[model samples]
Target chain A: MRLKCPANFRIVRLPCTGKIDVIHILRAFEKGADGVYVVGCMEGDCHFKSGNFRARKRVEQAAKILDKIGVGGERVKMFNLSSGEGPLFAQYSIEMDKKIKELGPNPVKVALQAKKKAA
Target chain B: MIIASKKPIEEIIQEVKDYKRLLILGCNECVTVCEAGGKKEVEVLASALRMHFIKEGNEKKIDEKTLERQCDHEYLEEIRGIVDNYDAILSLACGVGVQFTAEKYHSTPLIPGVNTCFLGANEQRGMWTERCQACGSCILARTGGICPISRCAKRVMNGPCGGSSKGKCEINKELDCAWQLIVDRLRDLGRLDDYEIVAPIKDWSTERAGGPRKVVREDVQV
Candidate 1:
């Protein structure tokens, strides 16, 4: 099945969602990613027994840290869908793109550009 | 092991805003086990601080390092060469590690990044419960290996105080009564008879009641 996601989004594949770490999510914002979302296997359907659950917890932790640093936790989210749900994957990506547009550019990225201009 | 928790980011930023060059130091021992002040935490904190400074349009240098153990002189020595490079150091160790590091480095200002909580055991990934108070006296033999001093809210030597009900402390229903646990343990060990023996008044001097305490073992000193 051929499906399309917004061009603004880039994908980083991993063996499993459990491979995601808080640092990986935070680094995205540091590198000026306007928003970040993790898509993992549906809850309880993880091939590794609980990898998806672990990924969700890490995602929640990342969101909390982002909120604490005033980066807007809502910019990060975790969604679960089965491997067969190709259409669902495309829909999620589009939804995320719309959400990021409403939030505008990450403040950290905007400040970085301003500093470069001043220099 | 000693358990600690990270301080709020706002509070930390307030304390270090005046400093230009800063180092976020982490301890790889107890703080590491508790997921508070460790190498991973150091990196996360460094990134967060850099972002905060950048978003505020302020220029600041933030560095990160994790030591084997900050409470030991030998481990503290590892950072000696770089200690002076920063205007201030943010230590993510427990209170003991923070003080020890401060003692070793005289000139640089030391800021604590985490609040040292207590001598505790991790119950699960993110749950730590206090276990010992280092009272300088060991009475676990008589209590059937359960400590009332740290576990009991009232610290009553002979108890299941009136505040205890259904094996839970009245202070918090979620908390198990220490004396209740002691009694249960004693019964299981066929030593319920020990429960009837009234304990002597504890010597409070051994605990923190006496100013700061110290231990000396000449044989252990090199």
Candidate 2:
């Protein structure tokens, strides 16, 4: 049951994945996060009825906005798994870590660093 | 209400690329209801634009503000103090709001962030359907409260035209034929006999053909 996920990741807990908004995802990248992924309750398993579904849509919206703004949408993702799937959760984290590493640092973060250097 | 949709980020960027200080203005009226240009939309857009400019190595000062209503002079006046700070204003309100805001602030360039679609009703979350064309006429009572001028592809008066089949418009299978809806409503009301009355030629002059119509309410004037 004990699995080691990537140490580079940080988790922000929400009462429900549905609580996640597009701005929250965008703000992650704005604050220099290399990648962001949301893990919601399994499809149709959300305690709040359609919370997971709403989360999925918002995640998609955030990804689209990221794509439109020149940041690869692939950097963000949503995964639905039941609460008991701890192993699967770790696996997903590792997969996302690999994907974000491949994509490299978020362009926004790099730009912010450059701006700071110039100042 | 007036329904609108966001302009593509690429087109919006092009419109304000020349400016340094920018204000992404939003309206809390119909645009807000339609989920087009609301306070939330202003934040999202501001974040996107900031990222765009940051990545380009030419970061600009982008600000956000949502007015109670941009179409009114009072709401437009709310920004008067901060108006001079921005080089240009990217208005996320409907076209009417944009025009009204521009009219009040003569010098600042007012750029539209959303394409004003039509007078519409929100069918559901994220779904809007055109309902009125502001044709300067009211015939809903005769048509059983459905507007043919706005719903019908051809705007026929007494219709169920050749293009209508199986309650659908030939122009778009997804669209319900306005006449079919009208006829069904009349029949339901036991007033199908009204369908026999031929409609007279419409007064085109009352519509947009009259050119930029205005109404003056003397009693409402302060």
Candidate 3:
């Protein structure tokens, strides 16, 4: 199965990634994302002192929920990035792409028996 | 918004007992607003499943994903290829979403991740309460926005069922008598005459009972 938007990874800017509500993260997966990660401000670097922390907590919660639904929670993640950290963002996306590659095609696309092989 | 709750983790796991691989899908619409099947809730359920399988000493591969809106076909396309890799789909959406997922993925056995509850509204942060009954009709616009169909235990359209006491539902004292609120509101607004008109009996069958409802808009449909 082909990953949704496999060729393009979107960087949605919010006032803070913490502003990236849990629903937005869930919506991404629903849209057939192979994997999704939330980028937040680095520790103690948030314009809003604890917004990063809030986003991290929310992302973690969303991941856990996904896991329970039999979807691998590992597909959703939270990370801290600083402004002007272009290289860091690139590395993060690359690492994420690699991780998804390892995870292989999303099972949602293939048949159950086929998923077994992919798994 | 509808208020629903997530099913017990064990109950959900049991539903997919035969599956070696599972795909958990969360809904970003109503479920997200209700805090039941959103991303955070999805993670909690995933962890519980993982721990359960771990204890069994049987390895189970589970993948997770959240959808923007489970009721929409466009959002479901995201899972088109990814879903084929999982044995079953556990939907963390309402009943409608679970059905939609099954409809979209005809081959995959779609299971509900949450119990669809009543039509409700958010009372406040982390609080929800039943509101509209959607009784194949609407009276909220006339009743000053409060719904008698939902608040009244018997869905009395005419008035209080004569069981109301102290403005609480006789069916359950804990509940408010919907008609009482309506009467009070009308009285306060000096529109008491609105209460005198007997409402026509609702034709339930014309509503949802006619079978799954559909609408084809010339403006939007090709």
The top-ranked prediction according to DockQ is: 1
Considering only chain B, report the TM-score of model 3. Answer: 0.93
Query: Which is the better candidate, 1 or 3, if ranked by lDDT?
Result: 1
Preferred candidate (DockQ higher): 1 or 2: 1
User: What tens digits encode model 1's per-residue C-alpha lDDT throughout B76-189?
Assistant: 999999988899999999999889999999888999999999999999989999999999898999999999999999899999899999999999999999999999999999
DockQ of all candidate complexes: 0.81, 0.77, 0.05
Q: How well is each residue in A1-119 modelled by candidate 1, as lDDT tens digits?
A: 77888999889999999999899998999999999999999998899998899989988988888888788899999999999999999999999999999999999999999989988
lDDT of each: 0.93, 0.93, 0.78
What C-alpha lDDT, on a 0 to 100 scale, does residue B12 get in candidate 1? 93
Where model 3 places Cα greater than 4 Å from the true spot, the runs are A1-119
CA shift of A19, model 1, Å:
1.5
Per-residue lDDT over A1-119 for candidate 2, one digit per residue giving the tens place of the 0 to 100 score: 77999889888999999898898988888788889999999898899999999999998998998998898799999999998999999999999999999999999989989989989
Rank by TM-score, descending? 2, 1, 3
Residue-level error in angstroms, candidate 3, position B23: 0.8
